[model samples]
Target: MSKQSEDLLPLWTLSTTETELPLSLTEPMTPSRLTELRAVLAALAESPIATLEAHPLSAPADTSKGISLGRMSPLAQELATLAAQSTRSVPKAAGNSGEVLYRMVVPAKVAAEVSGGVLEPMISKAVPGGVRSALVGTNGISAHASFVPATAGAAGGSAATVGVAAAGAGALTVAAPLVLLAVAAGASAHADHKRQLEIEKITALLEKLHEDRLDDERNRLDGCRSAIDKATAILLDKGKIGLSLGLDTAVHTIDTALASAQRRITDWRAALEKLPPDKVELRQLNDAIAGIESPGSEFYVHLELAELAIALKRRVIVLQAVEHAQQDDGNPFESFTNSINLDAQNLEKIVTGLRDVLLRLSTLQLDRSHGMRDFTFSSGAVDKLLNTSHRLRALGDRVEAGRSQSDVAIEMVQKVDGSIVVLPAMAAE
Candidate 1:
């Protein structure tokens, strides 16, 4: 066999970010409570073969994960634990046995509805005389125990993903009515008044995440606008250096700057929607931004400009990432030639990643209301229905893509000495 060259570029790739959180840090289940819960679990196991039972779908109790039953029913607050705990469409691996984890990350307001209408409706009463609500809840009963997973950071290194082996399974498949079934099956007269101060507190810190992301997008947009202003001002004084490539340098610069501003706004709004309402910032910023709409253009010219701006930003981020990677001990640069940029290996990875990003951008361009395959499904009320629908759909791998770190290409500026110039050191793909 012929010998192969040792020079091959590595790909730049970003790890998948964590999209879930723990519910709590404190253990709600006391030692006495755990003993009591174990008793209940035993009871359910020993229940008659024909008896029906159900455990509240809430996560099991643990000090590490901070998820607990807390005498609060799953119906009361769908997000008492992590909001990202919704049912995964992907089936569990074969032959896996343990708690089958389910997540329900409802919006704060919507969670209120679920709590009031389903979870803790019967536990409290405005009037002490009523037994009807208790009667309904008495038909089925569930006992939930809470547990916390270890802090996510201490569990994982560098990357955000929790250790897969440590993340326990969700609720088990039982043959009987279980704890929830028993709660519904029968109730004491005191059951209606028992620990009546039930309030389902969501442990999902989504609002913090949302506001942070919104600020991030907004800051990025502001940065783009600032860059354009500075660049435009500098160019007005220096004037265009006649490239004679049939493209006006000044006009294109302006176009690129404007494009960056628009893209930032788009990103900001999307991030805002992803966050919980409680975590959003004060209305003061909202009032400041009110009616101050960002530029909107339907023309392909604006679109091209925006694309250019994104490419510019991508290029910059890539280089910055490279600088950071150079410090990484894991970098495989030792095997590569010194003539090549240290991060040339990572370049291919970023370029590949950009494909997924381009698809997202494309979807945003194609459908403002529904991105990708998301479509309006409600009958008459289109806006409400489409907006309310759960965003549980996991984007497929093929739909995702990336770009090489340096793939955001600009027109090559040919120099007298024959070296081609790559402008905009840090540009987006």
Candidate 2:
């Protein structure tokens, strides 16, 4: 290959043992891992001999041309921007003829422990000469280049020196052994760099996916809270008249149910706050997301139950009004009948709505692993409402029967003739 092509290849690639970081690059970075990576990058920014730059490669092996930042993943793009901002000025070596670049590829785990404190130690130990410049990417790939000054007739120097000499002589000359070593080293490093970059891209994708899942959870929580608040307001309004109409039992039951719902909402909010900020271990990530998505506390079911309770309370109040009207001398029979019929229709609707809410509560699949308990408070409230429904139905039946008897008496009086009609006992006397 031409000299231009050769310059694009990394001089040497060093990596952590494969067994140490067996995770696929496409896998998510655990919260700890993300933290470690940030520390390592920060240290790289402060290193004296190393200056990190972002190489936006189109493909892992296509290092010749860099793609735009828009084409990269969010994490990758973010790191690239950071790398730009944190880049230190590269100190130029006086009278340096050229530079030999060295590249290292290590797992994020190793970089955090070793390079986070200082990069010079690791650089001096890994590369043959003093590194002049370096570039690091989110993929755990760091490329370093050392400056070498060209002098006339320099013999038995490093491979870079020999190459410079060969080029100046305008002849195809090779220091056979040094050239072989350089070729082998560059080839190995290039291979490792390519593999590491591939893995980093995968990690970026996983991070994005995890973030999307979290967004969905937040939105769901917001909707649940809004619904609960609306239901609470309605229940509170209904409870205001409880004392006036001797509905203390109904009011207390509903208030307790509302308190239970509010408590669950608080628990869910706290759980959400405790979720990992960035990413989590693959083994635990699925469980964590599931917990948020389908928590056992049942906020929605509680809201429905509360609304049902409110409907039942309203019906009871209407029933009381109808009873009071019956005793009023000005109340017409037709008006009393109309009010009773309306109450009956409303009662039927409440019963139907309650049944639907109960069915939903039964079929709901909650995440029981998240310490979910039984709905004792809500269940008790439902039972109370049901008993009230039955009693009201019975009372309406009795009222209708009494009304029928009164109608019969009135008809008999209207049918009586002007002359007195006496029973058989009275005529005999």
Candidate 3:
């Protein structure tokens, strides 16, 4: 390859490992609640005659009409989002209220400990009447009905209104009783209508919740697939470079490896079948996407670093020429002040660019094992990243410390030359 062509290749090497993190499934449930949920799920799955009680719909006072996950309480919104993602319809029965299940998606960390009818209790105090459960089945796990307390006497008032109406109607021979009977009848009917409205609202909220989660998972899966395609293109280019360099053996190996990687992408795409959005399924899809993204992200970072190295190298050449000009023919310091100023400004610009690169690296989410329980990195790549950051920091400090125009100019020249050595060595590694 020509010098220019060789320069086009990354100066720095990138490395990554295949990482798959198990999604979490542990949700905080009281021991009793977990038992009840297990029974409910078991009965629904295994028993022909198992029935679910129709709990009264009591909307939490703080809950908004539109369910916005992550806007309200983090834990509550998480639960709601999980419930939404897990929503699924079980078999429908003519006489019975057939079971409806919302698959619970928890982190893998949580799932590991939630087994054998044992729940890890994290709450110091049990919520008053705050019993929650999750039903696990072969297909997936689902959240149980969660009812929050309503306004103080809403439930009791409806029953009382009905009784009042009946009592007044029985004594209607008296004029006062007749008037009382009419008022009680109106109140009773209103209460019933209000309860029915609440039920409908809650039902709509649940449906919306399910739809939102379904859409979110679909979007995420699409994003991951797109990223994989992009990564595939990049790897193909790298393989072509190997071929151009007449590294026939290396090229053949790269082709084989890339082909396998491409097949994995296809497998991942197929795995994302339009299954019900359960925690386990969604988590698996997410991890599969991350597998591609981890390496892809690392690749781009090194690519940028290589480009920056080239630019720095050119800047160093310019600084050398400027320094030589100042030293030769007894050129006065004042005469070269303007030239020095220009170089100082340019050096500052490079510093800014390097800072941005470091920032990107810092924010990058590397491949983590077991749901980010442990962060993993390629030792070589990590060393390069840290060294680059340190050099940039030291250079920035030197630039900022320059007091006068001459100091700024001379320091900029020295730093650029020093960087040329450091960066190329990093790339060669």
Candidate 4:
């Protein structure tokens, strides 16, 4: 690629995007809220289409929605034009389009994380095939947008009241590996506690068998009674006594093994019952396994003994069913064989529903707040979300701004009216 081509590759601005989720329909959005929303959208839009080009399936519906850009709202058009006119004329970035533009917009980071890059290609595919992006010279343009919260942070360094709220809209992070290690270690320790139980069961069964073996007093008395009855009945009944004695000996052998097994089970149960509540999940599992008689259940018992570590290990399994699906790689188009699919994904579906509900409640709150012309949030959640945006905006501005590929942001300034995020640009075909 030529130097010009490289420059054009980065998103160029035709106009800055301004989200128009009507004040009447939304909680009056603050500058910081708008900033945060825009930053998130930008983060979403930053991902390159080439990164997603290999996927055979289409992007999800919401992802497409996030990248959407069309005829601007009239007020938006006016504001964009005014913003362009106000910024003092300067050198056009690299090549010469000479056309001053609005702040191009894109989805914020939250939207990107929530939807992935599904929307990027969807919008591109929708664009007319013949309409190639032909900017004058090599300067290609990126037109993008975002949403915002209605609250601003305070100045007295009271981050809680005026700045970023703790809930909802902070940076995305995960627990440390050490924490996971601890969880696994704890699980393993618990599993060890279970092994001791199985041993105790075996020990008890052996004792029960031995104790039942030598019951001489009762057996002798019964035998004497049998002899008396035989004498009264005559010679034919004496043969029956001998048969009964033999039968009793054989029955006791079988009875001893059964009693021993039962005792072993009782000991095992008692040992496991001593475990803490956290280990309860495992204890119940063992009990369930013991109750079953199938070979599968038997296998479960032995394997669990060896793999007590499995219970301790926790992992995020993505595309888990893909392994089985790969068995028929001889046919790619088969629905059952596609392991990495975009469909009725359970996790994504849940998040989508959650975002929708939040949006709906936000809309209702906006209607009630009368464009934030009043302090009337029905719930603390709305207020908290709004506050979080402001803090993110202030912090994000410090970290972003004037720090594009070329510009080095030294001691960042909070110049923009709202929140911000510095990340890659989204590709709209």
Q: Which candidate number has the best TM-score? A: 4
Each candidate structure's count of clashing pairs: 86, 2, 11, 40
lDDT of 1: 0.24
> Which of candidates 2 and 3 is the stronger one according to lDDT?
2
TM-score of each: 0.18, 0.16, 0.17, 0.19
Candidate 1 RMSD to the real structure: 27.8
lDDT of each: 0.24, 0.27, 0.25, 0.25
Residues 140-244, candidate 1, lDDT per residue (tens digit)? 322222222212122123211111222332122121111111111111111111112110001122222333543343333334433433332222222332334
- The segments of candidate 4 whose C-alpha lies over 4 angstroms from its true place after superposition are 1-117, 120-127, 130-138, 141-322, 333-344, 365-429
Per-residue accuracy of model 2 over 269-294 as CA lDDT, tens digit each: 44434545443322232243232222
List the candidate 2 regions with Cα displacement exceeding 4 Å: 1-296, 300-304, 307-315, 327-337, 343-350, 357-429
Q: Count backbone overlaps in model 1.
A: 86
lDDT of 4 at 53: 6
Native-to-model Cα distance after best TM-score fit, residue 201 in candidate 4, in Å: 54
Better of 2 and 3 by TM-score: 3
RMSD of 4: 32.2
